[model samples]
Target chain A: MKRTQFSLGFIVRRSMVHRRVRSLAALLALTVSAAVATTLLTLYVSLNRQLHQQFRAFGANIVLTAPDGSTLPSETLATVRAIAGSESRIVPFAYAVAQTADGAPIVVAGTDFNAARAMDSWWQVSRWPNAAAATPGSPVAAMVGTRAQGFLHGDDFPLTYNGHTLALHTEATLRTGAAEDSRIFIPLAAFTAWTGQSASTLEIQAPGSAAQVEDLLHRLRAALPGVQVHAVRQLVESEGRIVDRTRSLMLSSLVLIALTVGICVLATLTASVLERRRDFAIMKALGSTQHQVALLFLLEAALLALAGAAAGYLLGSLCAFGIGAWNFHATIPPLWQAAPAVLLLNLFVALLAAGLPMRILRTMEPATLLRGE
Target chain B: MATILQSAVGSEALIHLHGLTREYASRAGAVRALDQVTLTIERGEWVAVMGPSGSGKSTLVNILGCLDQPTHGSVRIAGTDVHQLSRQELDRFRAETIGFIFQQFHLIPYLTALENILLAQYFHSMTDEDEARRALASVGLGDRATHLPSQLSGGEQQRVCIARALINQPPILLADEPTGNLDAANQEIVQEHLRTLHRAGHTIVMVTHDPEMASLADRTVELHHGRIAAERRADLTAQK
Candidate 1:
């Protein structure tokens, strides 16, 4: 007899349509699992970078100082500038003990106020001194730390050091929760003139991975011979440890969630296939090869997985955006790079869930099933 | 033993069974369903199998349909020893050689009448919608092609089952109480279609308890306690 071959798609469509409730139940389970997996994976990829960037706000990772009691050469700033290049913020400090009008001594530090502000952006200051007003050699401003303000009789005061005195205009009160809160900040050129000393230390804000930072430190040490360059352990190590722990937590949670979801899908698929055993038996009795029967089931699962994965990608992307916004106060765009991996993951899960059901189909006897035994 | 059974039947015989035995383990121990039963049917013959409920009528049909295997025996259909065929080959053999009509209709409830016939064709090789439609028309169900099994009457559903059975154009047809669930009127309608198929040179093995239905067959074989009790030629009975 001349027969027309019905496409496999046609059969699967009819089967799913006929058992709409069961198909939908399986599809929903797969969709939810896919969504959760995709969401976690996307967020992990997107948020890891953001977390590192947030840590960057903590402060400079590298600090450079002179060796022994000798101060860094006046030309050391130029050498550091040449090596650190334009991307790095370099602030050099020269410290001296100066006496107030009340004869009480106060520690005074000199630095490029603009660079200092940029390097320590987290510092709370009542007002920032205008770098334009300082000019080249002018001492138009000095910032009094909140603690040092109590030692000064007024906002504008004169400090004498080594018979040389400079009148400093108070532009702001710096309230950093550190040693900076107990010192005075003046222009480095003016302090050098008053104390006859150049910059003693350098604070550098350099951005990159730990390897890149170490490379920069090596370059700085080699370039400026006697200068001692060291990474600030509290800043660099803490940042590395926090980022590592967060990534590990996200990865572990992602794996755990995927496994839990996979098991749920497995249970749903098993029950769905069990309910269709009679149909499979009929197919077997009608002369369907085991391969053909198995193909039908696998094809059904693949279709459901493909559909669920697509919907999940969209849902998970939205979820990632919402979570990023809620916690980081930043919009995280969808990490499209994770799409392929998510698809592979969903396919693996769907197939794994179908494993037990396919085994059941293989071992089922048409005669026994048809007899309702 | 197989040679003896094969030769006992004429060269034109399409089915030959030798020492077929099927046993099931019960709480009371092994119980035989078909005890060393042997039978043969020629090409283009309609044979009625009749027996009490537990006399192994269904077992015989299931074995012939290749849906079950006998513990000990050889079943040859068209000179092919089905027992020796692998599982996959048996599926192919069943597809190409046999069509079955069950007592319960067994039409997938979600599918329409036309789709039910197409399903059989799909399993056989492929489905031709035109052929499926024609099969439905042949069974007087062309107008109700779109009706689901649940929406059809018992007679209509049985007719759909018959159409599905014949869709693959197999040489042999096995009907296990095809009208067992139908009213007398519906039974007559289904039997008429069976008569048409038999006249068209198709070999048919029908299991039924109705003598009137059995009277339509070329011969009737009666089984008792898993053994053949009697065999009679319907033509001889008509002649007497």
Candidate 2:
């Protein structure tokens, strides 16, 4: 019994030494699925972080807008700002539409640029527009998005707006999420002067994590009457839901693939066990206990599973990472977090798949098993 | 005439089976592979079981080697009742008490002779590479230690199997048709080596259909329909 205690080294050697192909196949199946799971999970977490950062840079946690010409009362504005200040960063902007001298329609935003700068999560600036006056035709400058600048090709010069022609210079472009790509920014004075309107839309940033952003919006509504506000929660919810569905579909596909691999492993192992029945019988006849035979088979399985999992993980990850960078044109995280999980899961799967063959070991009657019936 | 019991207790007798029976159920029907049979093999005694196909010679050898269990009787080897032992205990007993040789040579194809021999020791010890090498040398395969089973001739492959069986220095060796797959010259060469092993005081039990091969052993037992048909002693032949 002591000699037959089933040492780890013995199991490993017997598995690899006796049945190389079946062991390798099983291990490969497990490793591949592990890598897939790891890579997908890592990408999901990282994407959420990236999206949240971009939304934060929009200069407020929440935004409230009213249709044209209904100015918010000064006291209502003061009360709204006060309630938001407890756990949020609040900013007010007057939103309207205007036309360039060439009759191109544009969105006009009038705001306190300094306060907006402090509240926005993601804004890059070469310089903030000056509040001081400029010539009648040439007003204080504004920042425009990359897509908005796309409309003003480099060759187009001395842009005109509102019946007055002024020099439109391209400053550094600030990016928002995909939805915000077409927006343009201008100084409040310039916008109010051109549009001849004096009403405001409120953008509020609630304190705490992104999850709490929604609660802040609800609280803001209860505090302020007749004011409508839009929170980043709307954006986050829709995006998160889409990501969840995608992850579910991807996981289901992986499971199916894993099942196929499991079958391959099972077939290989079962064949291996049948082929070696004589060997097992000989050993048993020579004094190998049933447990020792079982150990030998189990050890063989573990070795195969480990090898297959490692190879599959490496191969799958390489493909996934490559596609994310080249085809999708996105930065994929390094994905080291998935390695251990993949390895463990692969081992488990290999063991599970090897269960059928283990039964073959138990039923092996040494005298008969060796007879080649 | 000496009964099987008296000869079993002599300094030579290492295994004794009493009223042994083995039954098996296959798709065809229930079959009795071994009938009520009493036999004894002395320590260091080289013996052969000879009969036609399906005559239970292989079954008798399997019972002697502990690779099988008799359904109806007791099997005692080295003073231990084999039938009383658990499955794991039986494996340990086999590892410690017996070695086995086969007609096909059963050497793992991918492994070199050295690795193949070392395989037998795996279940018994943690590490014994040098011992395995020494065992291979005992069978005159030291030069061919690194050769795969495919690379070796039939005789050399059988030598590797012999080396593997001898690695543990067990008291009993069971060979099932060790030369059944060998060419005549290789068979003679293997037969010579087995004689040398017997001269060195290792107990060997072989099962074969060849009367010529059976002639080389110290004793021959003939089985027919799962029962002993005849038993002969080499000493008696020498005396005549």
Candidate 3:
């Protein structure tokens, strides 16, 4: 006499329970839609961070130098360092041509060894030669280029620069897929003392968004009027383009998958409703209003949407983590922003499918439908 | 039976119809499913409607049960002009004033037998599990309360249907070919239940092709081509 179950909810649960196969079909479609959406959306946000780090690894994006190959004032290095952000590393390079023992000319560059090594991550070195503690004619540890082995001839060689002969002891062989592979690297202090010259070029690894980097370049150029400042436009432009294109591609793919899943769910729900015409007719014959019958199907659809989206969000988060590991070599956290969109998309699809049957419910005659026709 | 007839609350004509007409659109112009029919049914009366196939018996039942609307007519049931009520009011009126029993039983396949009875109660007002169980026990289905329609035999399913229809204690029962799908023994069982309902003073409107089933009613009306062709009462039979 007291306890009574809310009948609409009861009907929804019983009807869905009875139609497990169809319910699962629709739920599966929704789950996959949410998962794919999550994967793409999570990746979309994280791709920019990952790609920026990758490009920074590839080397410097901004370069500063003097015009006509003239060396800048020694104070200019300090000036440029002050203007550049702390996250950036500015390495100075001084170049000189020294003749080997065989009288062959080889280019040499001197810079902060550690900063250069940190910025040029692609360079492979067997060992970094020690350039400390040396006399005028005494042998000094040198990093020999792989190509200069022919003329430089062994671990020990003699080089003459400005009529002064210096003995070189090779401690490392360097290989870079650039001109650096044919040159030698030494400590900037050592080269400056040996050649009596200051740095003529500065390589700046500015790690930030393209606009931020571009803004930095403009400030550096404006601050140093005599110095030539330019961005490595290839890397900067391509990085921007790649990130934009990747985001666009992910959005496009999510849209396509959502459409496909929506159509599939529509088909599944439509078939489910058609198959249960007898049930609807019986409910109507029992004096159920058209709105009540419609509520049953709508409630079932809403429940399926909620459950599928929740499960899918969890599944999609796992999938996004997997994609981050495989593609970006990083751990990407789930993007919570996609939860509402996924739920709404599934609801829209479910409602579209369920709403079609509501129209059919209005036109149906219980007597004709119950006649087993 | 006469003593039980006094159980009716009042005899102000439980159902009244005038110029009842229903038409359907067909490839060959309008098809009149029911044409110019006039009838009345009193509370506690058992009336059987006999007709051939396509004789509009289902159309009349559909109209009486408020499952469909007549093309041109007035239908007053339980002292309310049903045609004048809104769609929602009609549904409530139907649920409160009439119950349906189909030949196919038309029990929802997924619901248990007791749950089937509870469905009617749920639609009408509230679902009482205790009362639903009692309804099942009254129909000799106490042990079969948990059985789905698919698991129950034809006779058990029909009993579930009767329990479902009468759960709300409606004054009128519209049964269309109630035993058309049952074997002879099951038919007898179902017909005896109808007799008990009739003796209990529940007005019954039954459509059947079997004369034996029709003979159980106090009066029988014959329909032909959507018109009342003949009528017969228990005491005297008339052709017109």
Candidate 4:
């Protein structure tokens, strides 16, 4: 059937004007819900991404520190490597106290840099150093982690070697745990020549699975009763617990806000639909099919949603930017990153609240409404 | 002398109903508005329903217009059972077969005369700007096409309402107290328009309390307590 666009236009206009206050109230409720929901969802997604990136920067799958000046045995390292769940990169080394010509002191250590690289996926490498030398006279190069670099004042530092001072090159920064950056790395040959140590402490990373690393640590600790073993599993688990709690609180707060806004929107839309029931009935009695009536309600909802979304998107982005700038001293995510997500969320809220009025649309009786019954 | 061959042939019936009963529920009790009322209204016949108040005149008009359903009988307009049709189909049937003119001139206040006329075509046909214009012009409100309901005088507003009713070109026109709310001068104008519509071969059924209004019809049906109490032909009323 042919429809007069103008006639329908007048119907909508009359309906809106008939109860101006109610219409305004509904629009306001929908707009507020959209803004709050968009802001919270955007923050949640961005924060999760940032946290994941930070976690990836720490290279070690598992690091075990042995105390009391004891070196980890080769048998323990071999058993860890042979464990079904373990990865191939496991290195052990020892450390000793040494002094420079100026009588300043340092702890010289042995490490395997190649294997360490595989464990820390988010390591932002400025440069990769040449392989460590095989003999005593070979100079060692070390990459400082962020925390260690901070401790060392962002420059090369001197270490004592055989009563002489050797200046080590700080080739790059590894942003891992706080302590990994501060230590000095030398070839095992150089460490043995300098301190006469036979074996080294273990830095094990069974990257394939956490269980294998725990198993390896367990067996070693049992064999050498006097040796102390420290793995970061406890720290990671504790941090995970704290992060989970924070996430729960954030989610609950957001959900509460969304629910409150949703109810307000629902109330407004219900009132609007009730106030305009006569207009809808007249349209139907005039000859608008059920589909047409449904579309009319849908169109109204869409118009309201479009207005609310446009306003909310602008408000949400501004809020995100302001908070990021004032609190984090960084630019918020680009529009490309945040806008699509917010738009999708806004549309979802619109359709959900709109569903309520559409249900009411289904129950409208045209004859009764026209008769003013 | 054999001049009987010049006599008129009987007119065709446009609306037919059989054993129609319409009951309404009120706080007092169930009341029969149209009680087993069988009726046949001919095409091009301007009939008036006349009776005192609560005589079921409005109820019969409502039933004939397909605005209300009969509880015990069927209504057939143009050979279609209105009672058996779906709600949407019944609405379409009413729009296509009947045009109603009410005493209130129930023009949507916000709409202009032209827009009000266009609203009649909203659910039926596509845009009929020319038809709406012509309908208003036929009712002598062509110059007041853009005026709102409030802007038009009582007679002009009633004329716009008539134009809207005729825009669909239905076979029957149902008017409920078309001049009940009009002043004497406006009533004369509205009644003249109704006569003009009848003269143009439109079937009209009107409900009014005024005996003078009833005298204008080609036939009058007197209703009482939900029953047809009397029927009068225009020729007999005219000869008196």
Chain B TM-scores of the candidates: 0.93, 0.89, 0.94, 0.90
Among the numbered candidates, top lDDT falls to 1
DockQ of all predictions against the true structure, Cα-based: 0.47, 0.34, 0.59, 0.21
What 10-residue stretch in candidate 3 chain A is worst by lDDT?
A: A129-138
Q: Over the stretch A1-373, how does candidate 2's per-residue lDDT look in tens digits? A: 2233334465457546555565455555455565665556555545545444444554555777664568666676677767666545666677655555456666656676666777763565556555564456643466666566666656233434555554455444556655335555666666666656555777765544445666667776787657776766665565556555755776777667656655665565566666767666655654556777666666666766667657766765676677567744556655676677666776676566456666766665677677776
* Per-residue C-alpha lDDT of model 3 across residues B1-240, encoded as one tens digit per residue: 122223234448888889999999899999998999899888788889999999999899989998888999898777666778777776677777788999889998878898888889888888888888888887789999889999999988998999999989888999999999999998998999999999998999999999999999988988899999888897757848
- lDDT by residue for model 4 (A1-373), tens: 3344665555666645655676667667666776776677666655544443344345444554555565655465565566524434566666766663346555566555665565544556566555553234444576655544544543656667666556666766665444555556655655665566645566554332234446666765675565565567754454455456656776997899878877777666766665556666555445456666666666666667767767776777677677667754556663555556555655566566666766765564443455565
Q: Is candidate 2 or candidate 3 better by DockQ?
A: 3
User: Model 2 misses residue A304 by how many Å?
Assistant: 3.7
lDDT of 1 by residue, A57-77 (tens): 677888899987568987888
Each candidate's fnat, listed in order, reads 0.49, 0.44, 0.63, 0.23
- Clashes (backbone N, CA, C under 3 Å), per candidate, total 0, 28, 0, 5
Can you give the TM-score per candidate against the true fold? 0.85, 0.74, 0.88, 0.65
Per-residue error (Å), model 3, residue A4 = 4.6
Collision count of model 4: 5
C-alpha lDDT of candidate 3 relative to the true structure: 0.83
After TM-score superposition, the amount by which residue A170's alpha carbon in candidate 4 deviates from its true location, in angstroms, is 20
The candidate 1 chain B region of ten consecutive residues with least summed lDDT is: B1-10
Q: Compared to the true structure, candidate 1 yields what TM-score?
A: 0.85
> Which structure among the candidates has the greatest DockQ?
3
Can you write out model 4's per-residue Cα lDDT over B1-240, one digit (the tens) per residue? Answer: 011111112324567878878787899999887787777878799999888887888777777776666778877666666777776666667666678787777777767898888887876666677778888998888899888888988888888888888888777898989999888998898899899889988999999888888889998888888888788889755321
Candidate rank order under TM-score = 3, 1, 2, 4
Candidates sorted by DockQ, best first: 3, 1, 2, 4
